[model samples]
Target: MFGPRRAVFLDRDGVLVVPQFREGRSFAPTTLAEFAIYPDAPSCVARLKEAGFFTVVVSNQPDVGAGRTAREIVDEMSLRLRHAMPLDAIKICCHTSQCACRKPQPGMLLEAARELKLDLKESFMVGDRGSDIEAGAAAGCRTVFIDLGYTAEPPPERPNKIVGSFREAADWILSLPQEDS
Candidate 1:
């Protein structure tokens, strides 16, 4: 029988839309007006889908608890995201860092794996921060770091690949040998 499908888990904010930072902390962007898609996101995702890979997004948004943004705002932003690039599934950690679901914890990735029956070995993560890479690595998925220049703590672990943008990451994937299937 076929095992779980390969997937590409992407990061929101700096990877998808513009990250809203306030008071030296990350904030959930408040509106569609505030959310801007990175130039290559739409096409990058399309290529991944075309490549026979399940595309998911795993994000950490602690805005409500951090008081940096509201839950409504975050929800609204998600709606906008769906309208924009759209993913097969989106898994997010709305709670604070201590929550098991938060990135750097691997709970979200674990949950996605359980719910979707994903093949961790065949999956990869493309994100902008250390947490995104760490989370993917912890879950045994290959990781790619998108260097969009967020000022978070340095990644304790190195990702399997580091690219400047989503387009580049997609290109890397497409350029790989086709034996992956």
Candidate 2:
């Protein structure tokens, strides 16, 4: 019998979309107007899907908990992301760092694995931040860090691979050995 399917988990802002910047600070989009997807995002997602991996998105949106962005706007941004890519699922943690679902905690990836019946050991998580790497590592998934020279400190746990763009990340994931059916 086949075991759980392999999946590629992605981080939304900074990884899938062009992160918004305000006063030299990086931030997720607070409104639909501020949301902008990277040009390569669709193609990158499509490549992963075509390689027979389920594509999922795991994101941390702490602004919602901080009351800097409305839940409605977050939902709208999620809708746009889904419309823009062929993701199998998108798991969002709208809570603060204390929440278990937040990145660096692995709750989102773990929940996605449970819901999607994914083999975490055979899966991969790609992101731009250290928390994303830590989350993927904690969840037992290999990680790919898209290095965009962000100012944030590195993740405590190192990712399996570090690349310059999502395209490179897709290439790396596609090159991995396929899991047994």
Encode model 2's per-residue lDDT on 24-116: one tens digit a residue.
436788878788999999999998887778899898898998899998888888888889889899888888756788988899898888888
Cα lDDT tens digits for candidate 1, 21-85:
75543544656577777777887888888787778888887766777767777777777677777
lDDT of each: 0.77, 0.86
Provide backbone clash counts, one per model. 0, 0
- Clashing pairs for predicted structure model 2, backbone only: none
Error of 1 at 83 (Å): 2.0
TM-score of each: 0.86, 0.92
